[model samples]
Target chain A: MSALSLHGIRKDYGEARAVDDITLDFPDGQLTALLGPSGCGKTTLLRMIAGLEVPTAGTVTVGGRDITRVPAHKRKFGMVFQSFALFPHLTVRDNVAYALTIAGTARGEAAARADTLLDLVQLTGFGDRRIGQLSGGQKQRVAIARALAQEPEVFLLDEPMSALDAKLREEMQVELRLLQQRLGITTIVVTHDQREAMTMADRIIVMSKGRVEQAGTPQEIYHWPATGFVAGFIGRANFMDGVAQDGRIMVGGVALSLPRPAQFLTGSAVQLVCRPEGIRLGAGLAEVNSIEGRVTFVRDLGPVRDIYLETRLGRLVAEQSADQSRVLAVGDRVHLSLPPDALRLYPGLPVTLPATALAAE
Target chain B: MTVAAQIGPMAEVPPALRWGAVVNLLLWAIALLLCLVPFGLVLLISFGHKVEGAGWDWAFSSENYLRFFVGANWPAETTSLYLGQLYWSMRYAVVAAVLAVVTALPFTYLMTRQSRRAQARWLVFLLATLSLSEVFIVMGWDIILSNNSGLPMLFAASGVTDWLKDTGWFDVLRDWGLANPRNVKFKTSEFATVLTLSYLVWPYAVILLYPALSRLDPSLAEAARTMGARPWTVARTVILPAVRLPLMGTTLLLFVFLLGAYVAITVFADPSQHTTAVSIYENVRGSTLNAPFGAAQSVVLLVAAGAFLVLGQRLSRKSQGGA
Candidate 1:
């Protein structure tokens, strides 16, 4: 029942706005990721929510209580920092008991509780071991156990999987998500890795330049991207610039049609978005709204092959399942189908990208 | 040495060329020799015997050892006076060194929490004061506690002497020998000697403990704070236990350094309350003019210092191994 909310939050460091006016919320018992490229204010927003950083102008409410000025210690929100931050001097048992002992619990009782929590995190016999003795994954698990020792109202993790290797990262991702789901703790994770965000979060908040560009389930953000930036950031998308005319957009000699007139002013320039996964290779230009191009490169990624095609409109990369009957190699001529329904259009500017195209791309 | 061409292959090198690795090796060798020769001489001379009048004889003997332990009048005269001075020397060094490290721990922790620029500036300031000669520090305290220009003077000038006289607290100062008939005085007092000794090593204590305390992960303390510790509790639980080893090691090194102190003790201590270093000075180059006796005392102090250093190192190794 304790949901965390932020409204019109802004954090400025001198002349630069690290987190420009951004408003968002995390419903109780749900995991939301603040995803973006580095320096895009994702971590800044998460730190603000944790009360570690004070926002220049905004209100942060947790369970309907204003915590805008509340210090981090009083918030009691368990946090796992990127480095794990386990106390090097303490044994595993003492680190886990840190919360209970500090809160005036009896020594024996605190030790017992620490053991239970360690057991929960699967670090049961590691009590007497020093933090430095543990592997990267084990240390992160201890960090998680230490954070939960206080039974914090909300959980916060900042790039928790980044320190591990690729295989370990994947395993911990599933383990952590399952742990979060089992506890039903309201959690927020800050990460720039889209795959990581997609793996753990129930809803992903895609952010750019200190603003929430789009917020939705990972599936929604991936399939029905609200902006070109979302499409490019959440996954890969091939973009082509053109001008909208009636319900169709002309790109060089090829005229790409849309299901309806893109919501834009008449005669406005636009950019069209088509995902590589949806584009079919070796389909004749006449078969669908399509383009004719020469293959520039081919990437075989085990199960699928990415065919890079160069056209007068520009270069586009399309993914074809490796088992597909037709095979395209680098420098081979191929036709790519750009169906009208799959193509999302947005207005474009001469310099900056069109706002609508940001969602579609 | 200045003309490379004149010195053969070592010479045909450029003017700066003699700065070859060979020269670096020679430079290092000379550096080690410069530092070690005098101490080596002291070790050799500790075995030599004293002659009549002014000079000493060079002969291997255990007389110096026997003299140091039981005294010159020992099996026959029965004097433990010099050995007793050595005992007080160790005692005072232990207490003052421990006191300095205990106080420096918190101050160093606070200093490291400051920004890097601030830390550099502080290092400069502390190093400046730390490298200052001990003679100067004793002189400054000489003024402050001289009864005419310092704390006691201000106390009397402000009627604190009269107030203490009325409150009967002045009796405690008198009983402790911290006062004369009219007012409180720190001259020729243990309090003044210990204070100066602690101050002499206080900066050193901070410098010695700096790297360990500075590199301490801030996140660890923050993690403890988030776990519901108050500021004091965080320091007690996280900071203190974390720096305990360095704290003990710093104390031991400072104690070894303080064991050889002479100026502070001479300036502030009564003649009857003299330390072993003063006695060593007398035997080596002062009135006694007995170099062998002085070398024996040097060996004693060296042994004490070395033993403590080894103990500290062993303790550090033990802690590291356990970790």
Candidate 2:
């Protein structure tokens, strides 16, 4: 059964809708990530589930019970905030034991439980330290320990890794994921970073403009995006506008076939996206959709090389492994391939005219 | 070394350093004259002997201290009159400061939750009331508390006084000295004195607490709420503990400020219940005309204020260290 569910949740502030008609379910013992850019209502949706926000018009259900009217304190959902929000006046042990103490637990029992939780988070022997004395990662661990001390039905985190440095954020993401899996608690994390979401979530929900763009497994989201926005947002993709003619897409008069026939009717405007790594560089034996272009820029990342080319179709970026012996410089001429299986087509008028058409004119 | 390199920045250093030292010395001298000299003169006069007619002359003696502790005719018969005045002074200041802070705490917490524009408006209103002269404030309260016209007359006009008499609560009020022969009177009572003193320092309490309460991390409260803490529990466990030091410090400061209050005490307190501040006025410029004794009282009040300040600092520091 789904542990928590939000149905048609909406939050309207004046004329602006912070969260618009979001309906989602968090499966039990699974971690879900609400991923989006800044101001995309992911945090708002999370807050509504946490009972921190009252929905304008919707019902929230948990385990077959309607808890829409329940306030935050009554819900007892453990949440780790972006700032951690540890009480500076309390020692680490007291901070972890706060929920237990407030719930009328005995001091000895609460302290024992706090110690166990601190051990769970690998923060042993640091119980007597002040909150201000902890490092950023240590503070985050204490927050997690405090939240888990309640053994809440649902755990929520809002940008929990944003305050940590890049290196520590990645490590904590993996560590948090392991801890959540071991406990098998229903958890939801709100994050703007796609990599973090992919690393930690069992399922990822992509949101934009206060609406859910797509929700699926990370691989499915990466391999098959339901919208042009989702495709561009989830990963780096080179977009090209074309018109569907017969069973092929015509891009600057070069007809490129898709793995499956175009879904849109002939003569309808369509957008095509291909991942950079899917595009092969240099001449191949078969040249079905090959384009001649000059290299305008070469970015040599340690593991991969991104080759920027001004092609007849458009300005396309192609990626190659750094281990490959092909060394290309700026102003070098090259032929790029757009494989049929790697292309994704969506029906929409192009937002900007493709550079190929501008060159053709 | 090269001439340009040697003289480039070093040549300008000596004159600037000399000018800075001169300005620093001048500021220290002025500070000493303006801040310390008057206090020194007060201390010096505190030990001087009071002359016979109207003035006092410089002489090292402990007569003023002796008179403060006991009666003027010590060793023969003792009187705790001045000591009683000192006690009333501390009692009134303590009660009024505590009442003001307790009341202002809720107001300040609520005010800080408002928008900046609304907070600014509240500050303006509070400052306007805070700047009102003590004499004017005392007069205003006097009109409200007087037996002939204010609350007592209003109670009579509204039949509440008769109601109290019927309920036999009037006897209790009379026993407490809050009522006269026929009607309930508030003037010249401890109730009226402390009330007016609390009102006088209430705005100051709000202003002093504004910064600490406003800077409090609201997320801390919400975090507690999510941990299954009720609103009251969150306040007790999170908000109160966080602002504990500020509350104590604000109370101490308001107490010290109320120590020197003159008009409120003189107008509302009975003559026998008046504080050391009123006694200082009587000795300095009133009928007594004894300046040295007044200086001695002023020094005592200053010392009391300083003691409370140091106590507050130690308490805050201890709390911080314990945390």
> What are the RMSDs of all candidates, in order?
6.5, 3.7
| Candidate 2: segments with Cα more than 4 A from true spot | A265-267, A349-361, B1-13, B159-176
Per-residue lDDT of candidate 2, residues A264-284 (tens digit) = 799999998888888888766
Candidate 2 has what TM-score?
0.93
Best by lDDT: 2
The candidate scoring highest on DockQ is 2
Error of 1 at B168 (Å): 7.0
Using TM-score, give the best candidate's number. 2
Model 1, residue B303: C-alpha shift (Å): 1.6
Please write out the lDDT profile of model 1 over residues A254-305, one tens digit for every residue: 7777777667665778878888887766754556576678998888888988
User: How well does candidate 2 score on lDDT at residue B242?
Assistant: 94
Which stretches of candidate 1 lie above 4 Å from their native place? A244-250, A253-255, A267-269, A284-289, A345-361, B1-37, B47-52, B58-72, B75-80, B155-184, B314-323
True contacts kept of each: 0.62, 0.87
Cα deviation at B71, candidate 1, in Å, is 4.4
Note the DockQ of each predicted structure: 0.45, 0.74
